[model samples]
Target: MSANHPELLKLSSPIRCKILERVNKFKAKIEFDGRIEYAHINNTGRLREHLIRGKTGFCLRFEKPKKTKYRLFSIEVDGYGALIDTWIQGKAFERSLDLKLIPWLKGYRIIKRNVRLNKSIIDYLLRRGDEETYLELKSAVQRIDGYASYPDAPSIRARRQLRDLIRYVEDGGRATIVFMIGLRDVIGFRPNKDVDLEIHKLLLRGSQIGLEIRAIGVYYDLHRSSIRLWNPDVKTLI
Candidate 1:
């Protein structure tokens, strides 16, 4: 199958590496050029499946290193590279917006980014012809049963954000929660209820009310050597 949308971002000076071990939630050890090197992990999710020992990974040299010299952004998964960096996923989402690749979000313009909503910050504040929307983005790299799942580990912060969105919707405000599936192949997106039952229940309640829940898939295409928008409207299997 061909890509549904154009390349969103290219791997900037990506270096081939192998996952040696996970140092922590924010760091990992990789072997580059047959030398052990430390890589910074951007996502906070438990990436035990992706960061396994001897798994092939791709890293970009840090412009300024504080603790590590490289940032591990993608890992080889079933011959394709799964983009695991949340920041890069955000960039891909923004690029998709700029290109109008998301049909449902067409005509919406970003009025502000990182909008403060109560105690939490939404990813984007959008305006389209007198209507405003609060949008939040979550990255899903955990693959389960041919679907992209989220929150490989429990996240109190994520639960709080969902609650805030629910409240905003209850107050007659427009809100949307978008899951950025960072995998190349998936049947659709689903909340990992087993991992976080509260998130699953909250999503159900939010959908029952007036919250717009959507998903998009973006991943690093190993054959193309660049990140491509795989699916702009991946079905939300809620």
Candidate 2:
């Protein structure tokens, strides 16, 4: 976090578009497409006692209810699973996790570009001063006990993006991966080895090599209508 950082790097999400709004107790009056949908989500998983609002993707605050599927990409803690990333202000998740050094980007002008490398289209290319950055976004929706992972669900694209990121970094370019923690409670993001072994391996490899990994915790308050930074204790759930 820096004092003079560009707000363009961060994204904003409104509440009206969350997948499950007010999901702690029983959800009262859920609006869907002008009408209403089912209030209670039938919890079905080996996950602990925490209630996961949505299964795969993170919790989303809707901008226009339909402007896009989800206003923002985030996942909050519920009944069973541990709290993952929360309250992401903007589109920081797509930065490939290396953008933790935002303060470093302020001194120079940024040139943005999009190029296809390997089997995926890289989200963006950023060059400031003598530094060039390639980036992608990631989520830590789930984790395995022994191995620390990010994605809770299986993502082939995530694996591809990670591999691409590694390649770019392995080359002469400065690559960054941004893992946005959408939950207020998650302490860290692991690879979820039990669920996806390849993803787990990539995570370990990414850290082993030179991929910059940074995790931020977000807490959402509907009362004041704000999402803020928070750090909570996370225990092993393996």
Among the numbered candidates, top lDDT falls to 1
> What's the lDDT for all of these models?
0.91, 0.46
Which segments of model 1 are wrong by more than 4 Å?
1-5
Tens digit of per-residue lDDT, candidate 2, span 139-214: 4444344323455556788789889888877886677665544444444665567667887788678777787665
After the best TM-score superposition of candidate 2, give how far the Cα of residue 62 lies from its true spot, in angstroms. 6.5
Rate residue 99 of model 2 by lDDT.
39
Task: Give the per-residue Cα lDDT of candidate 2 at 33.
Answer: 52
Candidate 1 per-residue lDDT, tens place, 72-110, comes to 999998778899999999999999999999999999989
